[model samples]
Target: MAISDIKRYTHLTDTDVEALSAELAGIRRAVTTSLGAADAAYIRRTIAFQRLLDVAARLTIYSTRSLAGQLLGATALGVAKSVENMEIGHNISHGQWDWMNDPEIHSRNWEWDMAGPSSQWRYSHNYRHHVFSNVVGMDEDLGYGVLRVTRDQPWRPEHLLQPVRNLLLAATFEWGIALHDLHAEQDRTGTTAEKSALSRALIRKLARQVSKDYLLFPALSGRRWRRTLTANLTANLLRNLWAYVVIFCGHFPDGAEKFTRAELENETPAEWYLRQMLGAANFRAGPVMAFLSGNLCYQIEHHLFPDLPSNRYARISTQIQALCEKYNLPYTTGSLARQYLLTLRTIHKLALPDRFLRATSNDAPETASEQKVRAIHETRGTDGRTPRRRHRTRKAKRQVPHGV
Candidate 1:
């Protein structure tokens, strides 16, 4: 089912589609050419600032006993950790700065400050999630298989508790991501050897993180071991929660669209761009918030150009929004607070079955008599048209189990 078959955005013609694709390509080419010294300096400076903040926070927490010191240190450390995770780690892993040819900042060489291994994250996130966007079955980021986010997903009794599950998931988002990378939810169905391998890999990655944050840092604090431990825990939790919120706001907001597999069949490149636009939401924020959220505040642009430098999103966003308006497409966006609230609402709404809600198909209606006439005409290949009925094989005609 192509975009044309759906008739959801009937205003766009083939010429308009081509024009849109060409315009986007022009933006990409222009941006690529513009990437130079300034972009490299921005990434380097950010990394340096993040590291300095982390060190200062740790030093303060380890040396002082005052409540003010503890609060300041913990908050600073949390900000540093969140910045590293979102701005430095996430963008570097996306190869956004790789055009600079800096080995240190390259996706292949960078390791994120998270529980999930960089290699595993690239495969699951940069490749799978970016490629599929909000496609229901293909994009694992859609609820991460722990919650039902959209009405298109089949509802089960287990989903009834997702609202409660969401809090815990957000609090421990880094660990959840690690397990998600391993497909831990499907461990029961995996072969023993495969499960064992995945478990070992996850444990090894987790051990490295735990050793640094919990053991090594705390032990090095001398008399303030307990304080340091608490600070590290607090920092990790804050980063996790912030990342979870920002990500949820970008992905599952009220207007973010989700697509069924049927809608993706034989999708064209221009239609693929349309899917990314429809499936991502943006939030209004200042420069500081943009930096903290890794410029995922412009998530619609990010989804469309995942490997483009984060700084470029803001500059390009106005043009992208204008293009959407010209195409008469929905450009889902709002203030951060509104978007976050909408995400929470979506999660809570889909957590339980909505008996009154029903799934709608994109296919157009045809009367039985009209259908019979069309079928007969199609069988005869009349009016120079291919017969829809004769093209499908008997095996292809049989329905498979839903979602399989």
Candidate 2:
């Protein structure tokens, strides 16, 4: 079939497009109304209590380990608390608890209590990951010196030892990897230096407090120092390992795209969105796993509509898939276990010689006529009442998915 014919057949009609737009608007309205009706003070209090519970849980695991009797029980409790941090704590901190409340306040609170001062999962995962998406240079999830998960950029010498580095990072400093991108941002943006002197002083004080907890609290618990150290170490290790594995399983699968800025800049919004969907894999959908991962399994939906609450990801994904199909775009997804295996397979592929990593024709752009249709679809309506398009501009003939 001719490219123009394919384009006409695939692109959504204005009515279909309007329907998708209305669905998204309805979701926003529902979330806004729910937030407006919620008791903000109650949410704030509950979030505070949850933070305290998390701290208590962590301390309990440490103390239980020092006492050395219920190893399995302690581990289970620690895992449960970690899951809470991922779900409830993370959600509230994201201001997903009440949409009406100021996100900045909740973000600050989240950074303080739930995520720890060092954790940047909010900015890296929530902000940057969704905004920039599968684009390599922009997506902080790609690689952070420790894990060579995606092959978006040219291979570096350090990447040669990615397997070893990733394992060591998971074992020793998983939290550190989470914060690396945030630290890089602070350094690049000079925000770290712009902090008030008093704030800096307070941060030093907090660092000291955390250090004391790490160094002295375990020994002071009246248990054997060795036992206390071992327990604390094990708890930290397990927590980091779980975090690393879960995140890695989400996007580093085989067949996932690792697009460069050059490649992305040449594509239209529909094409970029399509690439993101195909490049990002979903985990298996289950209540427990969804709850634990904060509903990240619907990653494609999450990427396309980040403002929407996580609870509605699965429901919205169907709509997103329909839109993709209408545009003749790929909508990639898979079970959690399948995606995890794919990640291992991707790693193996990366292990191949650099010469074998060359791009194939499958990665290239579509015909000129296909490009023209994408351009027409992406053009803003001149009705002069709609929001002006603010996303990336297109340059090549490629399939891009529309926002729904």
Candidate 3:
């Protein structure tokens, strides 16, 4: 289908859009009220669990002789804890758990404790990503440069090996990618010179710490340095592999949408929302997968309602899909394995220079079949807005606290 046709295909009827919006608002209110009532118990449990994990991690590190074994144990524990941080703890800290909590505590937990330094994730994933998602320059999920997580970027010469490069980047720079927003924020806020100075200082400090802890400490404590290094490397590789596989399965599939800044700028809010729906992919949903990957499989729902705790996504997805169907909107979803294979195929296709090297030619003008689908939803627009189910007042949107 042509890009314009695809855009038109996802338009929702006024009634359906209003219904979905109301459903979303109801969920937000219900979750917030429940969380408020359960906040104290939730906080206590989170604190206790974190403390136990912290102590256990430290003990595991100190007690093992085989550095490889110790590293493996530590990595396993870290991955588990990180999942909790990303999913449950991060949501709690974001006030997704309880809108009634003190903002200061929520902000602190979000920044320093649970989600780490990826403030971009907050802006990109929570704010811009969910708000203006799938639009080029809006969703931070698109790789910053060279890497093509999204089809939006014009392909470069180096992108010919994108599949290999993506895998390598994921394995080697997964942690770096997680922290990229920190650097982006620094660039946005600080002068170039100031950012450079701070960067140098931070790098020096980190290097010194790594040298002292990873190199000197082992030697001085009479631990086997070589074994320690090997263990750490092996553990990191395994952990990163798991993380990459889980993350990559969400997006980067064939039939995904890509847009330039001009395209995004010209689109309406409803259009942009549809782009996100069509561009983003969802994985299989289940308790085990949710626990392991932090419920990211419900990526579309998460992008739609970032403030609602992720645990509620699976339950609401059916209603969301029904609303989409009623509205003729595209709700892109599939099994985890199926989506993963699709992503791989996309990567393989993107790896070739010819596929994307030229300015993406219009996909052989849209067929009659595509026009039929587009014609169905093309008549709907905002003229049908009603007082009872209009866009939330600007004040309501702004009432969400600053950190949130």
Candidate 4:
């Protein structure tokens, strides 16, 4: 379980690992001590803003049939729901603000504006996904039971249309996520028993979500029920698409690594951290966009310290990058636009079984950086903008020399 046992850390000595552990401990202590009035106020203010947006959106939709009203209402609702699902709910459920000990804001008590139940999500997402990460067989997030994300995952005929499947999944991401918790694939493959009770729990959770959005609220509008229903659907669709994009970009960009079960055997905490670093990607974004995405743009930091207050992710990103550099680790990051495109391209490429067919391809294939550059050249060079040679020179300048 020692860090040295991991192939990626072969260059590091035990003393080098001790240095990393100490550095990480220092970061945690500093951030933990800094958590107090500012952190609490930030979350409280965010909640209030989200509530204001939700109420305004709903009232506007109920009172007016105008196109402007509907647009405003839908946009506002989508933003509010995005904040709830990402910034508020996801972070809280990671126990980020649990240190405050406020009953309402506590992770255990906070239910999000998604189809999945908070408790179930905490188990599947906070515990399982965080622990297993991109371990091919173990990480449910690898394909979310729909498309082929890694070459190690056997491609099926269904995956031949993954580009279409990926789009549909994004549009209905909330429901997709809710169903993901069911582990239907496990049951189908006979790898595990069907947990009928968990399935029932998921169904009940879906029912509650449907009731709130499609049934209860629309009914409250009486004559305006149609408008309200349409608005709710629009809001949910927007939120789902946004979450899908952000989550996918963070975990499946070209540079993000995947692992086999053998690679994960006897993983120590340091090795676990290393796996997270390899498997996660970050994107460059500003405060507004970051907050909407739950600051998951700083995904490398979030994975390294899941329970850290998300607002602090941006603040500590520089330090984290420095630590990664010191340890000679890849701190994968890019513009949001670039990273998202990379993810989409990856989805399309893996749809074919070509990678699986080339047997030695797994051992000695294109490095992530090469794949990323090739993707960009193929996808973006049509505009006749930056010349290939100039782009290569720029990329070379950006890359840190190995063993630095």
Candidate 5:
């Protein structure tokens, strides 16, 4: 799995990898040093706007008497909830604004509106998922230990229902994440009492979340409780579905490569940086879409510097793209719709066992290893040399990849 004896599975050599790593580190340093009042003001204003929107939306839902007015209020509330969940809560929990030294904005103190506790999610997400990135067996976030995202992960008989499970996962993404994190917590080395404590924490968080949305708000509506209850349910589901789309587009797209445990052996910062660059994909977005997705359309940049302010990702992406071009690497990105379609393709394709797939585990779009480059070279000639490309006519057939 060695690429020019560097073991990074990339086109770059050891020296080139080191240089790439240094440039990335420099970008981080530049962004870190420039964190100023603008960054602080951005986060503060975001939080205030989200809270105000939430309150206004809730009031509209309660007071609106007409059906059209009810739908409008619920939709607005969903937008507000999505903004809070994606931009404010998600970034704050990443410790992105920790540099400001504001306790309210601190990662550890900011609990999200989801059913899962922020403390529990931090362990599974910031530590396990971010640190491991796309390393097959280690990064549980790779398909969240359920769907088969890569050929490297062998398919099972149960994966036949993956298409169905995919829908369910999207519709209930928040609940899935909550249970996923809880399961991750229990799987660790903990005594029975300790396990019970973790479960209780999740139960308490879930109770509070459920009550606030379903009970308290509806009860306040008196005879109109059913209408309020349905509105809250609709809003929560909308947020869940949107979060699912943003998340899946980032990790499971065709060009976002998956790695094996072998690659993590004696890993260096340079190699780690390379892994993240190759492992995460991005979707094209304007300012509005970026805000709606919590600026996660720059997921490659976020993965590169998880602790950096999320608002800075747009600028960081430009520098990252330049480095990718200089290093002759893939800056994997596309329109949001295209990226999601690619993700869905991978999901449905990998539902079958590997034998049914056309590509090897090492050379597929969603999976690759260092040997991948060598395999391409050897295919062209026995001397490990590549041949010239032959142009095809307009009438020539196109070769479709597996599960196209």
Candidate 6:
């Protein structure tokens, strides 16, 4: 029941979609050209701040005996990990700062502070996930190979535990992602040598991460080894939970649509742009809240311009919203708590089969297609025939280049 003809679904003509595409491209061009010393300075300052906070938190955890001090230290450390994993690592590996040409900050060279290899995650996230967005059966990120996020994805008995698995995933989000990527890597590597190399890379990453947090930090604490170990565990757990929340808020919330592969048939940049708009939700965020969420609260903008700098998303959002208004399209967003609740609702609701559900597959909150929207204005007279709206049915010209 996922959307197929995006044009018909939105009731936009070919001309309108094309004009919208041009306007969006203009926004990208303006942002791309404006990237300069300020952008570079922002990223550099963020990296420095993250590093300093991390060290200070670790030291506090090692030396301080007060419960309040331990809580503060663990929380600060968790924030550092979140910033590193989401803002810096996620953006950098998206090639956001590649124009800087700084090897230390380049996508190809910057390893992240998570269990997963940044290289593997880059390929999986940037290419597979971003490109596919919310396409059913294509975007593996939908429910993350666990929960049934939409009706299009068939229900299973195992899904009954999705709510429970959701909690477990939140607590160990990094490990879940790492395992997901590792599975993909294992499947792709045909030869024994290739598999061995992939396994070794993952092991090295795991050893580096675990030893840093568990062994090295605790040992360095000496007399306070127990305190340091507990602090590190707490920090990692908090970071994982925050990451999971931010990601789910942007993705599985209501109005973040799912699509059929049929939508991709002769898809235009305009359609892809529209899909990104319709397929990702945003949550309200102020400056601090935005930064902590890695500016992913502006997830619609991020999907629209994935390679653009994260700091610029707020500005891009205003433009995007204006464009949405101009086109009479729904700009899906809500408070952070609201978005997450909607996501949780979908997860729990979809755990059961369709028999228990009342809404039609095409009109459900978590799953809808062209027919749902069309039915809204479909008035049938005494003749028992519905009035038709003036809309384009055929696909648009595939003039835009397919993004990788």
The top-ranked prediction according to TM-score is 6
TM-score of 1: 0.85
State in Å the error of residue 374, model 2.
15
What is the C-alpha local distance difference test score of each model? 0.76, 0.53, 0.53, 0.77, 0.81, 0.86
TM-score of each: 0.85, 0.68, 0.71, 0.85, 0.92, 0.93
Query: What is the Cα-based TM-score of model 6?
Result: 0.93
Q: Which candidate tops lDDT?
A: 6
Model 4, 1-404: lDDT tens digits are 11123433224555666677678879988999889998999999999999999999999989877899898998899999999999999999999999999999999899898998877778778867898887767788887978877666777888889999999999999988887866633344343334666677778888999999999999999998989999999999999999999999898875567766776777667667666776788888889999999999988889989999999999888887777666655677888888888788768877888645442333222123223334445565555543232222111112321211
Which rank order by TM-score, best down to worst?
Answer: 6, 5, 4, 1, 3, 2
User: What pairs collide in candidate 1?
Assistant: none
Backbone clashes for every candidate come to 0, 5, 0, 0, 0, 0
Q: Write the per-residue lDDT of candidate 5 for residues 1-404, one digit (tens) a residue.
A: 11222333454578888899999989999999999999999999999998898889888988889999889888888888899898988899999999898998999799999989988888889888999888878889988877989776767999998999999999999999999998878878469998899999999999999999999999999998998899999999899999999999989887677777777888899998988887788888999899999999999999999889888899888888777656656677888888899899889998988888887776676665556655654564444321211211110111111111
- Model 4's TM-score against the true structure: 0.85
Model 6: CA > 4 A from native = 379-404
- Stretches > 4 Å off in candidate 2: 1-25, 34-69, 98-105, 112-126, 145-151, 190-213, 216-220, 224-228, 262-276, 321-329, 356-404
Tens-place lDDT per residue, model 6, 1-404, is 89898878776789989999999999999999999999999999999999999999988887787999999999999999999999999999999999999999999999999999998887678877899889998888888898899999998899999999999999999999998887666766789998788879999999999999999989988888999999999999999999999999999987788899999889988899999988888889899999999999999999999999999999999999888766756677888888899899999999999999999797687776777765654542223432222321211110111100
Model 4 alpha-carbon miss at residue 103, Å: 1.0
Error of 4 at 223 (Å): 2.0
Choose 3 or 4, whichever is better by TM-score. Answer: 4
* Tens-digit lDDT string for candidate 2 (86-199): 555565545565455566435455453222342445655566666566565677666564555544345666666776666676674444543464454454454546534334
Query: What's the CA error at residue 120 for candidate 1, in Å?
Result: 0.7
Model 5, CA-based lDDT: 0.81
